[model samples]
Target: MKRITVIGSGYVGTAVACLLSTKNMVAVIDTDKEIIHKLSKQISHLDDPQIKKYLKKNKNNLKFSTELTSAISKTDLYILCLPTDFLVSKNEFDTKNLKSVISELTELDPKVPILIKSTVPMHFTDEMNKEFNRDDIVFSPEFLREGQALYDSFYPSRIIFGSKKPSLATKIASIFKEAAKNSPQVLFSSAAESESIKLFSNSYLAMRVAFFNELDSLCLSKSFDAKKIIEGVCSDARIGNEYNNPSFGFGGYCLPKDTKQLISQFKDIPNSLITSVIQSNEKRKKYISNKIIEKKPKNVGIYRLQMKEGSDNFKESSVINIIKKIKNHKIPIIIYEPLLRKQTFLNSKVMTNFTEFAASASIILANRYNEELNPYLEKTFTRDIFQEN
Candidate 1:
């Protein structure tokens, strides 16, 4: 019965708090009133139904608070889950929140080990350790999907700890493994290596996405079956399967920023292909939008604004770029996303029914294909190389 306080109530933070609450005394903290309020009800803001179900089954151990200082009081472990949004002006991650939160926690409790699950710049933890004069700090990167945070936590593929101390690393890994996996991996390293692990992992996934998207662009241009080509290629053991679906571009929170951050780290260093990966994603979106324009469609309907399927996040989403490019040609656009109950998205009228959305638009652009748009397949414009929903 350890008292664990988790800061930041975003997707990753909420998932961590929910998962830890299964057997420990967990207090979730966030500055956002709505998020704290929702967690007080033992509910998840991720829009995932599993959270509600989990909370119903395990009700007594979880709580929410907005007061950071008080939440850290008397807690055995402090988890930092703040957002490190990619700042376009700086061309680097805005880690201001992470730095501030860590400083506050150290001032409040100097001895408490702070596990940072937030995505940060490479070697940030090592720098922080030097500045703070403490060895209790650690880094553990999270691979959470927008709406599937808890589900992924319950069955994480791997767990890596960025701790210099072997014992501390083992302690953190054991807890997570006990909650989720049978024999979860527990890799230990310096702060710099841990930070690189997260960035490199996401960048690789982005590269995979960019690769297939460019293939889709080539297929569309030459009038070939892009799906068959991908199936044949991915069938090879070297490529395997997963994340093979092509879309507007890779535009979730982690991929876009992480890829650019990796490239940014190479600003002074000699590099060609890493820089090209970032540029390629931007070019891919522009190409897809240009293809949509070439169809001579006056009205375009976006099936969903989210970056991927089963995700509630649209931050830095590629679909937004496509919309802007298409709208530049003065084409009217509509949307059909059940998650968006509002009348419009960025001024485009929201069409609730698939049939209505399909009927009104000359061309419907879908990032991921679905059977709901089956009847209008001929009129649908998509770069979904894997035809995966």
Candidate 2:
């Protein structure tokens, strides 16, 4: 079995480390003691139930540690899954975490291949290789949903490796293929092309979301049944029924940032549709905010701060922007998010009791509909026509 060291214990890192551990001697390294401690006890730090189940059954093949130096000894391969959030000012991803880990790993001068599973800008792998005078770095992007990370890893839509060495790429691909339950299509390409693939793929998904949201906006303006229209359009078979459900806009860890980063990459390249996708999401959010404002409610209750069900992340959530717009109109806001421990969020009062939260607001805004909100459907505002994410 190949000795693998996976850096970081976040969602991507945890899922990948677990997947690789199925056939390899894998050590999952993280700086957080709490995360390492939990992993040692076969507990997951993330919200994915599949990961929790996998960890319980696969603990024998995995090693959890906070010390990177100890974990790296005699490692056959290293996979980096560090965060690289997009920076609006620079119009690029802030890859400081990846750079720091790479610098430390290269300083050790280990003769092992390094796989980057983190999302990065175009030519990032080549730039790192040239800077460090190493040719062992490879870029492999991940396409995992927040709460379904492990399940997706077990049955990935595709597996791709971007490297200069064909033999090394093949070896790595074989390892991942062994872990997956299905035979996913595997592609090998240049590092830059792989990076572009990730950005373009996410941007395209965002475009689809925007297209439907704009359609919903038009339907709302004319009192047309968006559900019927969407159903009819998707029946063409080419359109397909997946990802057709509309929401406030496309917002999560990936789509918003990736689409914006893709737009930045097109600064010199001629493109109108790419930029419009970002604008369209913004327009959809404003349209939603105005609809809420038109009701003139005394207090607007936000059902959840999460982007979707079973997810704890609210960063870049569409409702956040909608909240900011609603606040400008001087309307009091009450948020009913159990995830928030604080009494206040975004300068709005947070209510823990669902009944009290529901009773206090004149109207509730839900981006994604839930069964609990069925009792208050008349006062609820949402665009979740399909009731699925």
Candidate 3:
């Protein structure tokens, strides 16, 4: 079995480690001691069920460590899955963490082929290769969803490798393909093209989300049947029927940052739709906030802080934006999220008891409808027409 080293133990890293460990000896390294401790006990820090199962079953082949030097020394194939958060002030991605990992690896002189699974700015991989004076680095974009990361990794839609060396690209693809249950289509292209593919792909999905949210906004203003209109429009074969569900906005780890990053890359280029997509999402959130304000509830009860179901991530979540807007209007608010252990969030009281939370607020704002809110459906305000996340 191939000895593979995966850096980072977040969503993408954990999923990749679990998938690869089924057939290869995988070492998962992260700076967080608590995450390392959890993984060492065959416990997954991520919320993905598939990842937890795989980690439990494949503990024999998987290794967890906080020491990067030791892990890199044992494996020739390295995968970097570090975070590259988008910085709004700089209008660029903060890739310092990724760069640090690469720097550490270079110092250790593993000299092995390194594959980047993190989403980065266009031409970043190529520039990094030149900066390090190494051609063995590759960029392979990951398209796994937050809640179903491992499931998506085990059955990828497509595999694209960005590498100048065909032999090394093939070897990287082989490892993923052998681990994946489905024989996905594999494509090799330049690093720049691969980066553009990732940015454009997520931006397109964001655009679709904006389109549906705008449609919902119009229906709300004109008092039209949004569900009927969506049904009729999506019935067209050309339009298809995916990503049409409406929410507060397209706020998640990928969509918001990717859309903004794509817009930032459009410098000197004539583009209207790309820039407007970002604006539309912001407008959608404001509209949702105003609608809640019109109700003039005693206290606004937030059903959940997460962006979607089965996910614990609240970073860049649309509901949080809605909460801020409501707070700005001098309205009292309470949050009900089981995932949060703290009694307070952003200066607002967090209700651990569901019954108390539901009873305190005269009206509730739910981004996505859930069955638990059924008894209080009349008091809930939501734009979830399809009841899907």
Candidate 4:
């Protein structure tokens, strides 16, 4: 078994570490002590059920630590899954964390291969290789959902590796294929093309979401059935149904930031479609908030802050933007997020008690539907038609 160390314990890192540990001696390194502590006890920091299951079953093969030096000895492979959040002022993803990790890893072990699974800008792998003066850096973008990250890794739709060395790339692909449950299609390409693949793949999904959301907005304005219209449109075999669900907007860690980064890469190129996708998301949120304000309810209740049903991520969630818009209209708001520990969020009262929360709000806004809200369906406002996150 290869000795592998996965840096960063976020969703991507955690999922990859768990999957690789099934057949390898895996060391998971994170800067946060609490996250490392949880994993050391065979507990997953994320809300993914598959991750938790892996931790329970594969605990013997995995080790968790806050420092990389402890696990750097004789490590055969180093995978980086650090964060690359979009910086609005710079109009690109902030790669400081990714670079820091790479710098440290190269210094600690110059000969070991480095695999980057983070979402980066187009041609970023080339830039990093040139900057570090190393050709062993490979970019393998992860196409994973927030809550189902581990499951997706276990049965990936496809596997891709972007590298300068064909032999190294092939070896890395083999490692992933061995860990995966199914024999997924594998592709090897230039580092730049692989980087582009990651950005373009997410940009396309964001566009689809924007399309369906705009359609939903039009239906709301014209008093038509969005569900039936979507059903008819997706029934066509060419379109095939996926990612057509309407919500407050496409707001998660990946879609919003990745779409913006993709646009930045279009620097001098004439493009209206991608620009429209970003605008459409903002417009959809405005439309949703306006619909809520039109009710002029005394107390508006937010059912959850998560972007999806099974996720615990609140970063860039569209619901937060909706709350901000409604707050501007001086609407009294109350949030019912069981995950929230504080008494207030964004200056609004936070209630963990569903009974009190349901009784208080004249209208409760939910981005996704929940069975718990069935009794208060009349007072709840949601765009979840199929309810299948």
Note the Cα lDDT for every prediction shown: 0.83, 0.91, 0.91, 0.93
- Give Cα distance to truth, residue 249, candidate 2, Å: 0.9
Residue 252, candidate 3: Cα error in Å is 1.3
Model 3, CA-based lDDT:
0.91
Steric collisions counted per model:
0, 0, 0, 0
Alpha carbon RMSD to native, model 2? 1.2
Window of ten residues with lowest summed lDDT in model 3: 101-110
Pairs of residues at least 3 apart in sequence or in different chains that clash in candidate 2:
none
Judged by whole-model lDDT over C-alpha atoms, candidate 2 comes out at 0.91
lDDT, residue 355, model 1: 81
Candidate 4 global lDDT = 0.93
Model 3: residues >4 Å from true position, as ranges? none
Q: Model 2 off-target regions past 4 Å?
A: none
Task: Give the TM-score ranking, best first.
Answer: 4, 3, 2, 1
- Clash tally for model 1: 0
TM-score of 1: 0.95
Let me know the TM-score candidate 2 reaches against the reference structure.
Answer: 0.97
> Residue 12 in model 3: shift from native, Å?
0.4
lDDT of 3 by residue, 55-77 (tens): 99999999999998777567869
- 1-389 per-residue lDDT for model 4 (tens digits): 89999998899999999899999999999999999998999877788898999999999999999988998776999999999999998999999889888888878888899999999998888888899899999999899898899889999999999999999999999999999999999999999899999999999999999999999999999999999999999999899898899888999999999999999999999988888899999999999999999988997999999998889999999999999999999999999999888899999999999999999989999999999999999999999988977
